[model samples]
Target: MQIAKVRGTVVSTQKDPSLRGTKLLLLQLLDEEGHTLPEYEVAADSVGAGVDEWVLISRSGHAACRVQGNEDRPLDAVVVAIIDTIYLEKRQIYNKREQYR
Candidate 1:
């Protein structure tokens, strides 16, 4: 699993049948410092993660397929969890509970 920030969403009029009702989100990869890298990914949402939320992303095709319960679907990434907070030692670095509210 990897960490990413939900930057926006993706809407497609025509998609594979397996991904018909799946929510596609744009995600920016984040390093340990919470800084976004240059790479971005379009991931299928499994945990109902929204924009600006920190999410745990699975980049494995098998994992993504398992999340959607469709083995035939072609998926490289999927949002597995919506993070609430990140604690580095005794310091609270990133917290979404306060940001969302």
Candidate 2:
């Protein structure tokens, strides 16, 4: 599991049957300091997430489990949660937020 900001979205005209009808988004990977990292990749969205939205991303098989409570979503990255509020008290910590943006 990792926290990343949704940088952009991706659309696939042709994909595997398992991944059909799934929405994919390009995520701008973030480090602990909330700084954007150069490494970026696309993720499939189970929860509706938009661009520039801070979202919780699950990778590989873990991502498949988050959706439908079963490991069959055929996804490498899924938007399991969206951040609403982030409060860092110098040490960098998540405080409170639940808008699911």
| Best candidate according to lDDT | 1
Candidate 2 local distance difference test against the native:
0.71
TM values, all candidates: 0.88, 0.74
Against the unseen true structure, what C-alpha lDDT does each candidate score? Answer: 0.85, 0.71
**What is the lDDT, from 0 to 100, of the residue 60 in candidate 1?**
87
The segments of candidate 1 whose C-alpha lies over 4 angstroms from its true place after superposition are none
Q: In candidate 1, what are the lDDT values of residues 1-101, reduced to their tens digit?
A: 87899999999988788777778899999987688889889988878887888998989888887874656779988888998888888988788878767
* TM-score, candidate number 1: 0.88
TM-score of 2: 0.74
Q: In candidate 2, what are the lDDT values of residues 2-76, reduced to their tens digit? A: 678877777777777666677788998887667888878687776787877777777777646757734555566
lDDT of 1: 0.85
Candidate closest to the true structure, highest TM-score = 1
Clashing pairs in 1: none
**Clashing pairs counted in every model:** 0, 1
